[model samples]
Target: MSATALPAGHALRRPVLDDLPEVYRLLVAHDVSVLGFPDLTEDDLRDEFTEPGFDPVTDGWLALDADGVAVGYAWACRKGTSADVDIDFYVHPDADPGLGGCLLTVVERRAGEIGRELGHGRIRAMVGCYRVALGEAALLAERGYTVVTTFHRMRVTLDGDLADLADLADLAGPPVPSGVTVRVCGTDEDLLRAAHGVKEVAFRGHFGTVPQSFDEWYGHFAKRSSTDWSQVWYAEFDDEPAAMLLATNAFVETDNAGYVQALGVHPRARGKGLAKLLLRISFAEMSRRGRTSAMLGVDTNNASGALSLYESVGMRPVLEIDVWRKAITLG
Candidate 1:
């Protein structure tokens, strides 16, 4: 750990695996202040440390006060081989206000180096801020980042009595299409591949989507401590894979809810009620598993009518997050 241009009594250093607890505490404090609840579990933070291409040594920085207590954290992560980089910085509400700018500067510099290494002429630095955090949003605006899009964290309460697929349809949505079947995706490699394929095809042209190989997709979830393979589901139209839904234990610890990590229906399969069908199926399964609620995030401006689809299934917006972007030239 070495001191950077931090305040006279503060220092910055690379975070190590041993710093998980302290880092989690810092993050929860920040989240609680801005979002009114701790949105990330310790396992979630652990997974971030091991994300496919993230290098804890060079891509992250931790700020500490004179007493050596953690006060801020920041990191820059490149999305696959693309020029789009996701960066986040959090400062303790009581910490020095300038600490965020210092940490962000380090993250931006690292993002540039990443873009140049990948042979990109320029990079887009993006960050997500809670809509209610006016100060944080203003800081990003001051640094030339503009709000690109807004995302809503939606949730639906599930009644535990959804005894069967038939009951699910009666309770929430229409019955599955004539030839469509929905089933839990076990650990079978072939089934996993099919689900991944459906996802890649379905998410094409969506905002901020970076295409990923099957191995990349699998490895990302496999490394997450919270991944539950049984929670993954896929749909088949006429015995051909046409949609997929991936759920995780992301909200189990904090909200006693099942988090829908990804839900997608192939282009050719749209407008056939597959999305709503999958949502209802997932809700039933989560309810059966004793989860009181199901949760997912969606882009408010999604052209695919996803927001309306979720709303139709009883999911309501519980939180709003804004994605901000700033273009950086790699020289």
Candidate 2:
């Protein structure tokens, strides 16, 4: 990738923990301009600093203007030593126009370096763009990135009527299939491991999925401030773990919504109502906790018909994000 120089009066450097507040502001500003509301939390910003296999010093960048105020930020993260890298960058809406492209070039170069270090001859860098950000999408297209798939941010409001329905359903007992039972995974190591196993098996064929060891998976989630053990649930068929769901407080800070981070059903357990049942249970719990809504993201092209399932549960698309991909040949 060719280098793009930043505008005059701007300086770029590695981001440090001290830059967290400024960087968070830059991100929120960018999102607010595009989506009309902030989609990130300070905790989410902090979690990125310690993501697995990510080195903020080398893989991240912060751009400041003449007064040394943060105007742009970017980072690239490798997926478990694989050639696939996830990248993201943001420029304040009022910042100079060229800052975003400059930051993207820097992170793309870093992604290439990561691929070479992994001894891979080719690599793929993926980024997500808000569907409404036409200018941003045009810039990415100019740099050779192409849309791979679209993802929808789906949400369901937990209003009084829905809350009442959820409570009635709970009183009627879980609507799970015969021989299947669902319960929270709690803090039990074995149960957590089982949940991890179910996630791996269930998402094996998902688009852009990279296999991760149980320790890797657990460490990644355990270190996140949004993680709540009480929100993790697993379903078993005939006493054998068959499905898993992980919920987090990701949207609680900004949207007052409970976020379903992951929901997967083992192949052996497909065709059963386990997934829907877990979602209903989650809605009940979120309502009980006084959350106004629940949200999750799903790939529109998911082969499992996840979009339909979510829609059947009264969830509607609130926003759309397009996944962009660019493949590079490593030297």
Candidate 3:
């Protein structure tokens, strides 16, 4: 594509590592405008660019204003040629609305080419935006995408005396019924496998469940330098594993917050208070470490009443994100 083809007064170019600083700045601007906080970091952008499926050369683009300043950016990728592709794009508040659509058009076009290369007849493109991004929402809807689900960023302050940590140990609720015990994981391979198993079994029935092989799942966390393996926990009933909690310190270094990356209870263990026990365990541990808070994201309409459960434990919704999807077919 040439500058002449771009929306008038805008120029598009493929992104390179040299553009990281500019990209990061644009992202921060977008985040501050949309979330009132700079929720992104240079490391986050680096990780996304290095992710397994991302191809920087063909999968990302930067839009510059007439003055040659980057004002918008977009990227698209799929996991191992999967038909389902994830797309993300950001535009500076001062950019032309047409620039946003222009980048989105390029992203969708690249997604289609990727789907074809993967031997898929059609591609399912998924995108997310803050609920307050009304213009983006309308743009997506007008382009045939429909809202499929919503997620809430939940958080709770973790403040208590070290000696009182014991009392806060079970914020989720009372201990699992008799014959059940929960404990954090160590660096044992068997233990990691068991934790992954519990998560797989527990979330199989969840909405939009996409099954990832064990290696793929574990590899993801292993690659994240901020993940804390010790924060991973498992709940056992009568010596049989039944639930798991995989957490990370990703937010700790940036926001001074502990994060629950994944939490699940096996179907057979439902209603046993295991979920609540694991949650409180996290709160207690985070507080003991002197973290200011703990946070996690949950589906707003979760069939398992997860929203109510989190609220019951004093975690309030701090932000909302909506996922939209559109089908792409190319002749």
lDDT of each: 0.88, 0.89, 0.82
lDDT tens string, model 3, 1-331? Answer: 3312566777788999989999999999998887788886687787777776687898999999989999999999885657888897899988876777777888998899889889999889989889998888988988899998999999887764333345354544344568987766767778888988998888875765677777887777777676778999988888887999988887886788899988898888789778878888888778778788889999887888888888877788888999999998877
TM-score of 1: 0.94
Cα RMSD to native, each candidate? 3.1, 2.1, 3.3
> How are the candidates ranked when ordered by TM-score, highest leading?
2, 1, 3
How high is each candidate's TM-score?
A: 0.94, 0.95, 0.90
* lDDT tens readout by residue for model 1, 1-331: 2213687798889999999999999999999988788889898999999898998899999999999999999999999998899999999989988888788889999999999989999999999999998878988998899999999999877764444334354544446769998778889888899999999999988889999999999999999988999988889999988999999988988888999999999998899889888877778677778889899999998999999988877778999999999999877
The residue pairs that clash in candidate 2, if any, are none
Residue 91 lDDT (model 3)? 92
The top-ranked prediction according to TM-score is: 2
lDDT score at residue 303, model 3, on the 0-100 scale = 87
Model 2: per-residue lDDT, tens digit, 1-331?
2349889899999999988999999999999999999888888989989887888998999999999999999999998888889998999999988888899999999999989888889999999999999988998999999999999999988754555344234523356668987878889988888999999999997998989998999899999999999999988999988999999999998888999999999999998878888888888788788888999999999999899989887789999999999999876
Better of 2 and 3 by lDDT: 2
RMSD versus native structure for model 2? 2.1
The alpha-carbon deviation from the true structure for residue 42 of candidate 2, after best TM-score superposition, in angstroms, is 1.0
